[model samples]
Target: MMINSDNLCMSCMKDIGTEKQCPYCGFHADSKQIEPYLPIRTVLGNRYLVGKLLEYNGDGATYMGLDLSTRESVNIREFFPENIAQRDPKTLGVFVMPEKETIYNECLQSFTEMWRKLMRLSGLSALIKVRDILEGNGTCYAITENIDGITLREYLLRNNVGYISWEKARPLLMPVLSTLGTLHASGIIHRGISPSTLVVAPDGKIRITGFSISPVRSARSELKCQLYNGYAAFEQYGFEGRQGTWTDIYGFGAVLYRTLIGTDPIDATERVTNDRLMVPGKFAEQLPAYVINGLVNALQIMPEDRTRTVEELRAELSASPSAVAGTGVEYEPVVPVTVKKPVAQRIVDEEDEEDYTYNKREAAKKRHNRSSAVIAVCAIIIVLAIAFLVLWQTGVIKIDNDTTTTAAAETVEVPNFVGKPYSEIVDNTYNTKNFTFEKNEVYNSTVEEGYVISQSVDVNKKVPVGTTIRLEVSKGKESIVFPTGGIIGTKYEDAQKYLTRLGFKVEKSIKLNLDNEIPDTVQGFSLEEGVSYEKGTTVFLFVWSEPETTAPEEEPTSEDETTLDDIVDDTIDKIINFGRGN
Candidate 1:
């Protein structure tokens, strides 16, 4: 009983030598290959049914997998360094002797401290939670719950949607702002907030992901991480040692500005500084004025002028009239009414002011009436003028020297010739005279179909009416079949010319590299080696590469020859044994 490569027992760490099942744990050893990394499905840890590879980044490669014990789908991120020396500080220092390990350690410690501070912050528990840490072959891996959503970058591209509509964008942006606020309050700064780092879920929830350059509270202040140019603050550009809440505020404003306007705010930074920021109404008119104003204020170059807290923005949004609807508030209309005064009271009031008040009321009423009358007369006159102009321009009415002309002029009646071919009319009847024939096409049912249908001019009338008579003729419906051609293996450029000569449009040709074994020609096309197409139809071809071109070639110069012994000695100032370092 020989055991195959895939049928290995976990406990014994050996191939299961021919038994009905694994003798160790009664588990079937013969499972399929999972992935490139894990060749065998069954492993020492609770067997995770390997699924599709989700994504890969500097942190790790994430895969969708199912836990056998729990029977639930889980995301597993496997972090493997492409080159161990790149990731391990100890090895990096040995390989690249000029590099400092203390600097690397300090950066890592800063990031770790920031992560702990952020995790302790309130309201961020659900946003990010450390699940577990697993130690693998010489490296550490952190496994977290898979965030089910599309990256903000993808969502923007797929929908051709941008941060234009506040109604559509508010949900996606509020959460990110809330998260940034929490981080700021906890004295942690997420120095990066680009579109790629923001993830928008199907439920409209947003989460900030990548935390590489995140900064935390430090004892000895010194800026360490590289500044993200796209979202970096002015202070970052100046290389200031101190970064506080305002630094994160700048990044948040940048992200918000980018989401609303398709481009980054800094692109218009000059315009903003020069007081020439384009009005949001010009791009998306439906966006509320106040919202645009708030965004512009937040993106102010001077950090002090910008909104200091996310709570202020949230309050402004909540207070907007657009946010309220159907909240049990009823609107009432106010009506004005006049009440008659009692005669005794009127007499007493009039005695104090009488004649002057009476005269003023009369003048006001008269002025109102006169204005109404003037407006009515003007409107009537304008209406009449417009009616007369319309009638005159359209020639609906015309007056002439005490006489009216009804445009009765000379015309010619159409001849009833039903069964005439197109050539006969041009050669015989309408030929030898001052008249010409204009050919046209028309569908006829009553008339014999292939002859003249009708004419544009009338049958017959009088004087100065010598005009060319237009004719309608038809060709009997006929169909022609296109010929098929031969297929030949040739270069792509030559194949196109050959197909064109055969009256076929070369639609597409895919070229594939070939090895020395196969000829560097179109091995074949998608069609039957060589096939002809209709006169105007296109032909598609596919070319494949040979093994020689597909394989990678070894370098002609070896590493020892490429490196100068003198330069190596000068850099290191000593000879170190690479084999003994590990």
Candidate 2:
């Protein structure tokens, strides 16, 4: 293998001459990387040149990497489950413990599957894009795009007020709520939703990242759990509790609370023992009534009593309350309403206490009238109750405890949609009448076109009527045509964006610009122009590397020079002055 040392520093991917240390980034090219982590410049999949270890948890380590096929920088997530796995020093492969091999394989599979699903959901507004998935060195790797932004935590700390107003937070948080809803619909629950996991981009939009397998997010699992103190839900702390979308709702509400109230809420574990969180009274004046109400409901200690869905949470936050009724709670009266105070109470003024006279006779008369009306209503209710009891004794009216009330929504069993023709699902009233179907078309070689490949909701599962079931219909084998014109000599960023918008992954390669070519411009594509390829094809884009420039060294001048004798004399004078107490 030939090493290309000219115009490239592997540590920082900067253009520099062959040197041990990278002057641009202070990275040493020949510095020994820590064991268990891949060595600097170690290539994965013969494409990604791995760099420094960015961060790691019990699940795996993330590294800064450059795609050799494309000159773009990317984040490579390697699945090295530290709990049950070890690194082979010589081969740089992960070695699982003798008894934990099955667990390791399962976790690796989970890491792979999660990234694959996230790859399908890449275009979500706030989700971090998963570029590709690879299996190498006895483990799996997920390639995610490097986002240039600070965490929501840092963003909040940088704010002058320490907290954000409801008006400012609504727009920032609503998009994330929408993205979380989409993730839930796709059967992905972000149990670790928090300000730390959320990145605020340069555009001021939030990007959701920090995804891991279920065990890493839950307590008492095989791996070490990484739960955010105040943001984790109560259910996450227990193994028996079933975690779902409601779990993320708790974390989301905590993030919102931190943003709006300017402090971390009580941790769910502590709240269980002593449930009290103090949101400042001033925040009530700053935030809307419904926004606070939504936060309270979402941050409920109990899962069943909490806001169960993202749509419900969003609606609640937006002043449209959709309260979930628990065992004894009634849903109708939960909507907050403003009421006018009585005229007598309204008339009280502290400053004008001596000016107004108390009307004792009027107040007494009003109380008597209200008591008489209440008595009359009670007499009518008693008479009706007696008549109903008499009729029940004579078997005129029978009580049935098993009867379903109008308030309880009727549930229908979900019908099997797999292997059914898409035409049959839409055109047939029997299938379409019970539920609203959301269709996603994908290419599958085995399944015929126009047939349902799979459904999100399982068959025979009882769900409420009008529940949405996501269906993936087949589109046969994909025949995606690569876009034409204005690609070569254009900026690679723009070209990559265009290609990505067309559902193609861009693999960038750097080429030396011998001619007077524009730096970072798209030189050419590996795929032929106007050619059709399968869906999700990696388009290799060769970009022109920027011309190397060396920094000019300055000549030694009298003003710029600092002599050793001058330093010594200054130190001695300081010592003498200190001794003399001058």
Candidate 3:
């Protein structure tokens, strides 16, 4: 329950019905951040209290809100497609631009489908949680549980001071990789898996945050999706490119590359022209060869050459001696031969605050070390002279020394637990006798519903034989049920949103205007919108048709276009008539 207190300061999630002032920061709620939209202190859907305008990502304007029912802080993401549609200040109706009406409706449908998909994925723990989806201010609001953690970018900068060793990074990456693998297998691609999107929770857990249907993608019928230059894959840039699971893999690889190297790799667009990306091993020899190879393979510019799946990438990243041998890299379980260099301390200007006493202290310590070395040398010489004198006086010397030691415990090999059944592993005879196991059930895309997807302990590792290992078991894909609610007569957008919000999938079609009916209004539904159905039941919606407008009659300005050809044809006709008369 480590909530990100950074965004929560604007309002007390615990005190949902409190005063207008922000409980933590004491900032007035009347601060109007964005314009041409809902003003400050506007309570959306009558329950979530709007606090502050968090950000204006390309797709929507996000607001930190408080849910009264749960009394928890939540991020309310509004589907404000500012490019194609806008909210009318006076009436508060979402009006699509006259030219972009068709695309607007399509984008709206896509938004609905995206939220529905998210609702279906509650089994995936690392995926951001969605509390509720509601219509507000003539647009849709997706309420997600607020996460409390620093971004991976912040963690890298603050904790690592720039970059970290592979040993430290391996553990940090496993949880995210496991979650992302399930997402990919469930036919979901993050599309945006940059350092900023990953949160390192206060409890040292990884929570992938910032889910936005990037509005700048050109490949699909939908207009545009948000695209990051350095992080986006090659296919995501244009309509001709084929985007798939590999698309997200590229972004994930880019983030991995960026974090490991402390710098952004070449942008996908630029990589096509000239790729000079230095491998991790090339830049840092101390890193494991397998990890270096894994990173390099993941960052391949072409999807065909790239690590095609999350499992493939994970296997490479978690490569053992045999795994590295399969990849043609020399396998050695010992420390790297290259000497690792310590991170250099930053140089400061003479007048800089960090320069004053620290420099003096460092210099004094070096001088003291030199003086101590000289004193020690003199003392050693005097001791040697005294020892020689004693030996001469005694004419003979005798010495004796004795040592005692104890034998160490013999170590035994750890067992392989990959793809093991959770039920059997938990209450198994061998499991109880030799080792202890901790099991967690999570949604797995490739692994069977009851089998283990991953284990914390390495297989065949000799560690006093009975080492306790933590295992993550798969529950398969979680089923989503369409919720039932009253939506007999609502606005077409409202109806689609209503059905969608209630977990009932919707398919809409406008009826032909044989009777000159109104357009974009909920005319009828194939099934009763009030009645609940099983999850993923698509309810076809019939919208009222708009009267077709005839194009204005064009002026007769085309008379001269047939001039030369018409005159020639007339002459030929006259000759033919003369010949017939003769």
Candidate 4:
């Protein structure tokens, strides 16, 4: 069966000719998209062919797209903060209210900058890969690889128990944890890490999607917040709350709670008022003690009380009663204790009040009797001892002495610190007094700055308490003198690779050319060639492109443009497409 690439279905990207309904995906081709969303088959960057709108949030809209160059499917994310920005149907460009222009532009930059960082940090197994970023239509677009899988929500629903055991979930979630730690190190915090943002592939691996700017995920920003009730941290609910790694920790803990308890935890706001979210006794019994403790601490309502780092959360999960005995931190397992009476219960009924009074009197009487008995027994024992002592004074008693022994010093295993952020570990080691860290700074190409490159003590080696472990922290890659004259006239692709290889962030912008010149070649650069620049410096390249040719214009109807109301309503229902893509 032959398929026409030009006549592809917007819903599934499959070929469907002349039929109003797609046979493959069961999508009605004639069904119109809502206002403010990209129209079906809209082309972007002269390469990506945007299909149906997949999902939208406070930050932007995501669409199913096809990479025209490769004919492969991709996910396109557009920056369109609804609360502060509006769309011009005539020009397909976004405009903001004059007063909110600054905030809108700031958030837009944040959206693009976050994606740029993610683009550089791609290839982590637990994270969706960001492929390319381009600017147009008064906004930014991030192109990411599409995942063929279902959301974690659906995955849990498909399971018989609607949950998984700790053993089954540990391997699946550890990658996400590690990836989060890396993201935090890179100054990126994913405030939205709920089940809907997590995708489970056919291989049974979970990958995180739905990345957005801070304002979109937090409350009281210029944009409307799209926070997951049970997954969002308490700090995200208020503008004055300071958020850090702990914000993501709360979401991560909520995810684990859902994965193990077979239900969503109570919303953070509700928990703040009336905290009734606890793991069921049945599920708690099924999980490891350390795991339950880890979940509780990570899901604390207050950020100060919550697990502050992925490393700490992992430690809690891996610890045992014996392992943490002398670590100064107690990991108490959750047990369902039955209390005969409520600690704060009040007796309102006459009969209940009378019974309580009677019980109190009975308890006092029993205490008095026990004290009298103890005192009488002690007097009799003292009298007997006095008589015996008097006899012993006459040399009637003899005693034997035995040798005493001294206990050995306590020892603890040295923890692995290589490749960890030195700042995170220093405080713990110093406070615990188990080991002392002697820090040294050095330049390294492989290790990230502020991270431990090497440690003097071997990991897992049993050492006595107060051992001084020398650590060398990375100062990041050493600065290098820019190479002379090799970056000017090369092709854009070649130049990008060259600049990136020399430790610089390369950004390319298309320069339209009417004069006969090489297309896709570098026309100019933002930085001078022979100057010393620090690693990770952004270098912009002006690339020549073919002159624009006039094409038949398509008028955008009311249904083709997305309104603020459309985005607001769509956000509430966007979870339906969580399994679709980013």
Comparing candidate 1 with candidate 4, which one achieves the higher TM-score? 4
Model 4: lowest-lDDT 10 consecutive positions: 336-345
Q: Residue 17 of model 2: what lDDT?
A: 79
Off by over 4 Å in 4: 1-4, 324-582
TM-score of each: 0.40, 0.54, 0.52, 0.56
Ranking according to TM-score, highest score first: 4, 2, 3, 1
What would you estimate as the lDDT of candidate 4? 0.78
lDDT over C-alpha atoms for residue 499 of model 4: 82
Candidate 1 residue lDDT tens string, 1-582: 222334444323344666646776554454332222333332214445443344432223445554455544455555432212133433311121135344434544454455456446524622544444444443333444456677776777666656556777786777777777777677667656667667776666777765543321121123222333346655553333345565566576667666766765542224334534343444435555445545544555555444456665555444454432222211112110011110111111212533212233554577599899999999999999999999988999675778866565433333333344445444331121223568787544334334565555554322233466677664432222333344446666776777677566665554555445344456555544334333456557665445543457776766545557768785564435544572
Candidate 2, after superposition: displacement of residue 47 in Å? 0.5
TM-score of 2: 0.54
- lDDT, model 1, position 118: 45
In candidate 4, what are the lDDT values of residues 429-490, reduced to their tens digit?
Answer: 11144577799999886776787888999986878767889999999878866678877779
Error of 1 at 138 (Å): 6.8
**How many times do residue backbones clash in model 2?**
4
Winning model by TM-score: 4
Residue 82 miss distance in model 2 (angstroms): 1.1
- The Cα local distance difference test for each model comes to 0.49, 0.78, 0.65, 0.78
lDDT of 2 by residue, 1-582 (tens): 434534566555676676767888776565445556788878898888788776665588888888777677789999987658888878998899889988888988888888899999999989999989999789999999888789998999999877888878989989999999999998899888888899998899999999989898886577756677789888987734579888998899999999988888788877876766755667755565566667777787777556678887777676532322211222122222111111111122223432223355665688699899999999999999999999999999999989957766657667557766677566433245457989999888567677788999987687886889999998977778887888998999999999988878999999987776789998889888789887788999999998766689989999989999999999999999999999
Residue 521 local lDDT, model 1: 50
Clashes of 1: 13
Models, CA RMSD each: 31.6, 31.7, 32.6, 32.7
